[model samples]
Target: MADVACEISARGFLNSLLREWTGWSLAPAAEAEMEAGPGDGRLRIPLPSRGSVVEIAVVHRSSVGLHVFRLPFREHRAGAPARIMAFAEFAAAVAHEPAIVGPEAARAAPAFLGRVFQSLSAIEDALARAPAPGLGLHADPSFQEAERALRFGHAVHPTPRSRDGFTPEDARTFAPEYGRGFPLRWWSAAPDAIVQGTSRAETAADLSAGLAAEDPALDRRIPAAAEGRVLLPMHPWQAARLTLDPAVDALFRSSQLIDHGSGGSPWFATTSLRSLYAPHARVMLKHSLSLRLTNSLRLIKPVECARGLAVDALLQGSVGAAIAARWPRFHILGEPGYLALRGADGAVLPQTIVALRDNPFRGSGQRPAAVLAALCEIDPDGRGSALADTILRIAEREGGGAQGAETVALRWFGSFLDLVVGPLLGMQCAFGLLFGAHQQNLVLGLDDGWPAEAFFRDCQGTGFVREFLPVLAEAAPGLDLGSGHRFTAAEAARIMAYYLIVNSVFAVIGAIAIAGLAREAVLIRQLRRFVEALAGTDLPDKTCLRLLLDAPTLGSKGNFMICFRNINENTDVTDPLAHYAGLPNPLAVAPAEVRP
Candidate 1:
């Protein structure tokens, strides 16, 4: 158990280090100074401040430059023969001095390490439990299992499972990995106190009532509340935290906000911890969690909430209908409405806000849709990834072996591009809208283990270009599509490329390589061929395509740097494209010929 814990911690630390190294463009000249003998993965890094060199053995090296190293140096201070420490310890030993490393990083190191350790502990706890049966996607899989199957939250993120505000008990109950379901804490809000962002329904009360109708128990609970008041559901954690706010407290005291407490059909926490899946209800509820998860607090900001409705309204128009007609397989899980409590001063209670999301996997035609992140996730039990497992099955049916696996991999990758990448590009080029098509936000529908359809979620991270504002306004008037989230052509191109190409497509290829199903080089060639063919089309925005084909480096989000700087991701920057650093563009490199 201790060894497993240590291993987990080391992996987290190495991921952090890799992000810092690559994202910050750290001097590789220093790394080149060390020499590794033939078949030797050992390297000695000089620690000038410590006046010593730390010897490390390479455990694993990712194609994206994430290298996990096991420290094998003796502890001189402790007088131990040999000691093993994670990257955090090694970073402290070499770069703790304020002069050596920046003051911000020096201060943030302890907090970052603490989160990494917490994440490691959580992952260890998750892995200790018996591996869930068959990738949680059998002939007919439960939605909860598909959600829980994403044991590790983020692929490239350093502390993907870290929940700073959560206690051990809270994690056991609310974390997706535990597969625990609990009733949401309910609140009865006066009609005057309720704020509706934008809804197809007549009023805010109607929206709340509509949501309640999904669950019979919840519906029953609503009428039992104070007369003329609407029932609003809240995450228990958020409900508890809201008590600290003076405005919310005032509302509670005035009886404007009646706490009905937790009672209703239980909702299971999805992979994105804040979103809850109500299996019986066939609706997903995204609540505002004040608790920090990954980069930011999982709260639905006012602008973001508005953006959801704006997106929904836009998608209901002629342009949206055209998109649907062109690419029927591509679906957007719309956030049709949002509800929140407003104080006497017209201030929104952020903690009380919740967005109503569409659940595509409720009934027939639901067809096993696996979150792309979950599909890429490596099973701790060495059973391989859901994606690899699915592909392997297909390969076995076609004729088993390395050659068969490669053939299946190629076919799957091609199909994945047509279903996912093609539609995403079309949306961006034609509509000037870009979906945040990262692995987590994308759900790929599988037809007998082959990619058939793609569904995208999360409106908050979606991007729109300024150049297309007039066109959008003409298409959908009266909608506040202008949330100041506009991006320039270059900015939109970079952001889209980073999310779709670097994060989604490249990450999947890396996963395939790690699974030993196919080489990354082959996958890269396949991606290039697909893009080159697309480039020949008469597309509106060739910026992304041109950049992908011509650019020497691609933008990559700096998660480690973001943590080190302690930036509030919500309001830190006006331009999100600035959050990324230049990374080597694999697509631009000389393409390998496809195997005949």
Candidate 2:
């Protein structure tokens, strides 16, 4: 716990807090807002109950919500010196402002603030630690190195690092910022008690057993459990937490599931925290965590595991080949197999679910792959980002100075638009497949900081357009992903636009702008042109593209509301719209130019 008075990155913290605060209001809102004040580069936000207003000095502003403000936020009264307030004080006042949160923010304030403090402390810790792999040493940095570089977490999100269920020590040991790795705790389950699924002919048992054999420690202990037992690998944290559950204990007593103790080549935590990666291992393991991080429980449900296998099926069929041939630079990181244990009543245990994801970075073949979120994140210390560094490095290599740098940034962003946006839009318009192409899930294979290929992961967030079901069926007969995977054209439009345009593409624009490489509107203009060129093509379901080009407002994730309402995005299956709020479209504001 941090003292409310104790602060780290006060200006940066306040900027992020207020950004999320007013940004939420830009969409359909409960109360908080920023009123443009007399064209003086100031934002005047009123606190109705307190009868005072907060004034912020805008430095770098964006038509989108990515505004950077000058320090020392002043609270103005009817007759006061505009009292300068601390970040915590400002956060507290905003939280209690009923006009903004309708009294709900007051109740949720402490839980939210406590997590914010934890996140801030984590950032401070990350800043002090040296780059784990000696980052610049490797010509092509490992995938884990890029994952570790996301010290600040989500760009527009508050409490990006608050691991609610973790202790400070646990946060240091398990969180990606710390660059921690641990041996997995092994387990063996009777084949009857194990529920398994795979896209290929190989059984989960066969995969797990083969992986276990690679680890001599687990390999030696496996035979003792039983000759016919199925082996499973679990995160040390998940294994420890699950061992405390009564149901798990009961199963242990009955010999249905036996613990083989901890052993394996050490696996490091990735940006997602719950997902573990090992360079030597053939697969990355995505474990089900009970803790709430961000808007959802990190636990993997059977449905989510099933979704990954379905993706593998799609990738194996003609549909996959066509998508591959169309967008050679795009990749899908699908889970080939998954394993979970069943309870006494034959119910799947959520905590026991483990997903085996394909690891291209395995062995000596590690690539300079990083999620877009990491590359775009601004250093709270005002040192810019890995992306900025990459752009500048490229500029230097090409014998360029200050003016030349902007040109490099522009060209770099254009490649990103091609490699990322092209395939994502193609997936939507042509195939009627919608990927959760959020920044964190979209990893770019970088060549000297230039995006070369797109690797989209987490198949759980995928959706199929019902209108294109017949097309999908004919092309990929292997995709029978069942209910919830199918969505109406309207639902697909909202999801595709929100994920591809709002979350993923917008982050790149923000990064380039925030780094001072280019103006926000300039990048927005380029984006508009990119969309214009794509929409000119012959693809079906141009709804998302049209919305990008014409919609006054688009749907955005209401991160503030989700935290205040205590909604779990993963489990909130009924009202998926709860995650959405209205966001002013930057494309609407950026002036479009007449092209020859």
Candidate 3:
């Protein structure tokens, strides 16, 4: 395993620890004041348990609150000579310190540290088999290839790459970064056991034929399975897990469920480990899993499945058609259907659930629609990212030989504002529909190196602004917006501002800065202009815009808090919003500017 890869992961973890303590007001008055950038010096953090301080050097600062730090954290104790501590020790120290994470949260530290080590091991394992990040920089890769490109996971996450309930071999075979593919495990379920909601012309049975086509050998055998039942496909790892469940075994013996074993084309795991993709498949299959990934268990909830159908129905109605008419180039990858098994006891099996998402990049309709998270991730070699390489190429070729990278970056930033950012805000402004367009949820389609269009996915995350309910009711009379899909204006603005601007756009800005292509201040100024441009328009909802322009801070999901407390995100119903915390707003400080 490459030690440098481990070192990068280690540095990122510590940087996140410092960012949380500093940005979230967890650190004390002294420890939270460390500035980032060249010549800013190192940050010394106290390890209360060991009675020592770990000093980390600040190499670069992100305008989005997370800073890049130098590794090899040195532990300084009172009388003894200073010695270097490894990443494991650092993780333990953070858990041991109540001031860093609250006393209640510190109790969950041991569980947190276990996952941290698992994440490091997973990173090392993936790096062994995965292609070098430098390779993806130049190539116009396939959608699946781009999906496999995230070497270092979430930009600011503490345990970004960890996998729970995964053996090293299972991880290698199933994780996206490993770039491995295996056929799906299929189970045939009786009609009574199937619970399905579809907006597609083809049912799950029809889609199963598509999967069968990918493997000619399985095509003939599926006729028997497809005769009178729905063929449910599962992620191979999830299938092995369900095999051990007594509930699943009972169904198999009772003839309500029949195992079809592993068949069809080998679908590669995407960045979201539970979601699988085959190049020629008609739909992207998202199977439910019992495993915990990051902050949530991978089980697919019934309410989420219901939301996908509801959003699809809404898009097919008046509101969607109106939005499409205004932004002709804008698109949403509609999830037409979801299927799950219902136990004989009449309860939905979360593990048996699968969501069928529209696949615009699969088969004949394929294009270079790159997931923004994968594009913005720091390359494994630590040179830069795929975003850096692509943006630099745009500058070099499209800058007309006179303008520099920064100038081209400014122009490119403007186009991005129009293509991706504008419609996203416009959807909320005019229609009250909020897509959870975080880096992982949104994809950008490139045209000769420039962003030409955007695709938003994850229909289950769609939200309606409560203030605009009357307007929505009038526009789409019979539209079923779903039960808990509504958010108050303040709630909508806070979460939308974070996902769209802070989490998504800031990462794009940071990618440029981290690549040494341009300063973040310049891009922040351009972003300010983009918001001003919106100010020039007559938006239906300005609450979100107002937050971006005026608020001193925007709400951000605290990954550190979630990890420290061992919170299961999907299962948290009563206080799911409690994980959100305020992040220092960079735009509030940027000198406002507008250009015609």
Candidate 4:
């Protein structure tokens, strides 16, 4: 009993002190063998659930044995006890709650004893297998000379300590709305905060109200309160580094969506607030894609988004910049942009990722017609002007410079095709449609109320199968699919399905959705007209051609619809002319692979 208490007390001190300060928790106790003998043993306590497993080794001085405490994965899956408490604070808490140790604990201890002893058996087995002294060129160590020993390996470990190194100067300031739940160091009297719900509305409201009543100098009006909704301001550098302009900053300060859309509810439709600062500060505020239309969708995880943004910022700043010279309106913001946030855990929030838009798209409303008119008004003579030069270059290089509308469409399609199948595919499996032809990813350069240039934005949404696997492995190495460092082919296939069917397809759908909501017929009419013009004289099916040409409509493959599109066998096999027949897709399931 004395030995058990001593072991437990030593472990309890570490768990209740050092580990707690470092945001670590003690797993249920486990048994470990100290040496090959039956009496040599101790208990081990595991750290809390983190990306990696950290074990606390406790040695039983008398028994000279070791036991490891590990919460069974099954138990963790079932219900593991976890508390984010401070060491000093929680020690006081435990002292006050002595009832925490009870008959239930006694019962739990015996179960842990069985597990600990089992582990000790394995340790003893290992020690027994150690090589005899003088087995190799050198004899065992001085200490090992008294006993048989095996080769030794080295390891590194961090000593557990408090996260108290965080100071007021290190305090990362964020807008009140985004401040909840984030760890912060403050000089003020009242600074501790915890988010009770995932709703941005509730969090923002509480934060705004709290700040207004507390701080007098700071202007609360920065957060626009519309329909009881507040736009929460967040720091950009922590999770992602997206570039933006002053206009985007102002947009972040002034914009507010009707806060009903839940976090990561992919289908939740709401307004978008964009501000860019690539060339100059340009702000765009629009009400669209909110809870009414978007509740069914799932947003990608934030870590996944961070990876994409890093890739984009790196690529666009280098190789992409060289090619982007032709598309002058496509701008890259040089610094990170602020964000509005709402979500639980590390989930992606339904917030804008601001960047500099040198020339912004006039969303499907009034400004589009002007852009279209500008495209038409360009000099037909094909001399001077960058636009004409590009068109001529396309004519000379691609399809024998097919003239008129055919030449333009062919050039556009050919450029898009080359980008996707070439550079885009070379990276890894990516998500967003390689070319977000829709207004969402596209912007028109305006020269005197006319569209003189066209560009694509949201490059971060672009994805590759190869780029993601390493990141995924780093986060969870067990998920690695063998074949060394690269992702297994099976993993690649899954990513391909997600990229093509979910990300790319849905982007197209979003474009279409924006189009369908047109208050004026001009947007749709001009689109149809452009399609007709592009398809002139070519006897291709106009419906199919329009479907392929119209950017927004082509991009709308959202989640639910993707499940339907993901059918196994072309059940229409009997219809001899089924679309799936001889479709050379590697992802296509052989009739044999399908479930019987």
State every prediction's TM-score relative to the real structure. 0.90, 0.91, 0.93, 0.28
lDDT of 4 by residue, 196-260 (tens): 12112233234433433333333433323322343332222222221233323333344322221
Off by over 4 Å in 3: 23-40, 78-80, 213-217, 381-383, 398-403, 590-596
Select the stronger candidate by lDDT from 2 and 4: 2
Q: Global lDDT for candidate 1?
A: 0.73
Highest-TM-score candidate: 3
Per-prediction CA RMSD (Å):
3.8, 4.3, 3.4, 29.5
Which prediction has more favorable lDDT, 2 or 3? 3
Measured by TM-score, how close is model 3 to the native structure? 0.93
Per-residue CA lDDT of candidate 2, range 1-596, in tens? 13221233343344345534562222111122243332226656788888888766555556666665554567879976768876667767877888876778767878877776777776666666635333322344568887877776666666666677888788778888787778888888888899999988888778877787765444475545656888888888888989898888888999888887877677888889999888777788899998988778898888877877877888788888999999998999878899998988999999989998887777666777887877777655343666777788888878889888899999999999999998988888888888888888988898876777889888866788898889878776646767337787777888877888877787777767777898877888888889989999999878778888888878877776676667788877565655677777878654644221
- Candidate 3: what lDDT? 0.76
Name the regions of candidate 2 deviating beyond 4 angstroms: 1-40, 129-140, 216-219, 223-226, 589-596
Q: Which candidate comes out best when scored by lDDT? A: 3
lDDT (10s digit) by residue, model 1, range 1-596: 44554544455454554544622222233352253322225444444555545565554445554344443333233345545555557646533634333566567767866777677777777777625546623442445566788876666666778887998788888888788889888788887898876646554456556556766666574556655787787888788889888889999999889887687778888889999887665457899887888788777888888888788888889878989999999999888777899988998877788888878877433577788877877655332677787788787777867789888888888899999999998888878997888988898887778877888999867778888889899998777877637887788889999899888887678667767777777788888888898889988778888899879888888776676566667767666777787777878876643342
Task: Give the candidates in order of TM-score, highest first.
Answer: 3, 2, 1, 4
Off by over 4 Å in 4: 1-295, 298-301, 312-412, 415-439, 442-455, 459-464, 467-596
Q: What is the lDDT of residue 449 in candidate 2?
A: 63
Clashing pairs in 3: none
